[model samples]
Target: MTAAGGGAAGEVDEGPLDEIDRLDAAAYEAFMSEVYDALGGRGRDLPARELHGGLVEARGAVHRAALTAEDVATVLDGSLVEAIESVGRLQTQLGAVGFTLAREAAVRGLHRDVALSLTDWLRVRCPWLSTQEAAQITEVVKACDSPVTAQIGDAVRDGTVPLHRAALVARTMSRLEGSLDVDQREAYAEIATRAAGRRDLADKDLARVCHQLVEDLLHEAAPGERERAAQELRSVTTRRVGPGLTRVTIDAPDGVAATINGVLTSSLAAPAPVKDEQGQVLEPDTRSPAQRRFDALATTIQRGVGRPGAPPSTARATVLLMIPFDPAGGVPSGPATTAAGDYVAPRQAAEVACSADVTPVWLSADGAPLALGRDARYATPAQWKALAVRDGGCSFPGCSALPQWCDTHHLDHWARGGHTDVARMALLCGRHHTHVHQHDLTATVSGGTVTWHV
Candidate 1:
């Protein structure tokens, strides 16, 4: 039959694909019924070996049919939401077909020897698939090993839900293996399947719901069992990826989770952008909440590291940066890099250095002390406090940088007769400080407000 209810030998389906994709409910139901039949049928009583070849051909046909879908520059008929639903249906169908093939191949013991492992066979047959993708299929096969989960296997094959959601069901059931009785787990599997069937269920939400179900099941368990399960759930692991980057994972309980959330929320409470005296953004903060959360973690770690209340052995991690100062003046000639290869602005490094215990080392060209670790250019503690209180934050009019982030700037370039006194001081954050010196911004201090005459 033709696409337009005509006889065969006519043209294939044509027109705006976007329009064709949103066929009425009756037509869609009929088309899905035909697809269901193909998914269930084994072609013409083929021998077991040839059946694999038939399965490959069927997969290719489905792939090609999906590829025929045309992307429209603009929606002409149905809404984009419906188009998205159609894509989901197609993907679920494809996943079901692939999982079924894996289960069949494994069950039939096709080349199930050590020399040509299942992984090897999958790599050869599904050449485009990654190792992880093949491993997921292996997991699905193992999950279906039980007669109890037979319904989940069937639902997955018939595209009642997606592979990821099915995988969640499988994994959740596995976690309950030694904990719950077989009957309890089988009952939970039904909940997983029903939840997975929802069109709007995202993978995260699916995992969340499955996890809650497990927790609910455990709620009725003996106190000792509950405590053991809670103990087993706690974990903290860190894997170093690079010179200074580490990925940390935590399975924190309610109290710890709340503590982390509170710290991060406080970290993000202030306005984001660092501004210049001209009310221009000195640094734009475009980081998302997730990214900001990591930054907050870093900030919290830095703040707590080797502090007063820490263990006696945690005296401090000594950090000494030998920043090159321009001989003509004390201005930093370039960037300052930490021992761990983290490049930081001179002003920002100075802020960290302000709090850290420092034994400054200065060497002349002849390896002599430039001045016994004392530079006349360095501001006194009193001077720093006066600057902080007077300027409030970055002296830039609209900048909301906290005092901790602000650096005391010389109203007159220190290279050109600026004194290290309160009258000669202004406060600016790292970016604005760089801008002021680099662009030679004109400046003045009157009362508590420091004005910049660019």
Candidate 2:
């Protein structure tokens, strides 16, 4: 099949080709020959029905041949990976043909003549196609027929782009109708065409790119439109897979996703060993990453719901959120990045900061710390280390919560005529801290030991 730039699909353009380019040309030639041989060089000369029937026959022949693992080892020069790729490539090309045909059917008004909706009409001939798949094809054809995505459609027809990639580009472009300018639309379509030629990217990776691109564009939409679009996309669903197993699926915009992931990841800790009353070694915790995440989420939810014994916060105080701000430009800089390098929208980051006990660190253009904002009353790292060593754990009587799980509480009440000093502070779990405040309990520190009077 011909590519968009007057060359065979996968052929290198005229240039001083590198070794990788030469390898790509050789591989493409081999792939083309393999595809041609697989089709018996009929070259679309036969009727559509006959060609399809021949394809089915060929598939049956391969199935009946019943090539074993040993035969696979002996076949060609080595393994069956090449066979898989050849078949997979042909499958992708044939799938693109269906989309091309759908576009033609749409333009000819065949669905109208049959008095069926385009989706139903397409599904009538291809009963295996799901309702969603049929609707997607109809949408793709409509988008391709439009002037905005005409070039993308042409690439799909010429076998330069896969149908699935075209579908993603079409869906994204359709949502961005009024939001994008002519140049933007053209550039986006061109990008999609180029992305289609990237054989290295899997469909899922390409889908992510499409989603991110659409999200960035959505940010530029008219006021309230971006929020509306985001709200429409956000969803959560739960289903019971078995008696004791449940599956929860969450879909959200990037900002919300980032926050949720941050909260979950921050809550995660290595499972402690189950100990006997003597504090002797016992069975080690054996939770998988997914199980740990589930526990963290459950714990977070319990705290959010004001459960009696739940901690107010599970995240560490040291989590750094790096979001660029431009005071001079007075415009949004870019997405915020978490300590874990996950991206969060700046607006969401600001929302998080509103209620969070955040200590902002101002930085210069070169990222040197200019100042720490309002941290005089907070514990320093050295102070925290000293307290952790001194307290051994939460200072509340009979509480086994570790220092990492506790916060520094001022025994003399920092808000009520008390100074910030290690001598007057004790490590307390969230529940006990709240309890102490509610009951006006007193604590005495002597010889680096704390005694709480309930």
Candidate topping TM-score: 1
| Clash count, predicted structure 2 | 0
Candidate 2 on 160-236: residue-level lDDT in tens?
Answer: 77776777777767766655777887888777667766899788887787777777777777767776666555667
Top candidate on lDDT is: 2
What TM-score does structure 2 among the candidates reach? Answer: 0.39
Show the colliding residue pairs in model 1.
none
At residue 361, candidate 2 shows an lDDT of: 41
The Cα local distance difference test for each model comes to 0.66, 0.68
Writing each residue's lDDT as its tens digit, candidate 1 over 187-284 gives: 88888888988878877888899879867856877888876555445667575789988888776656677888887788454348888989899898
Clashing pairs in 2: none
- For candidate 1, give the lDDT: 0.66
Query: Candidates' TM-scores?
Result: 0.40, 0.39
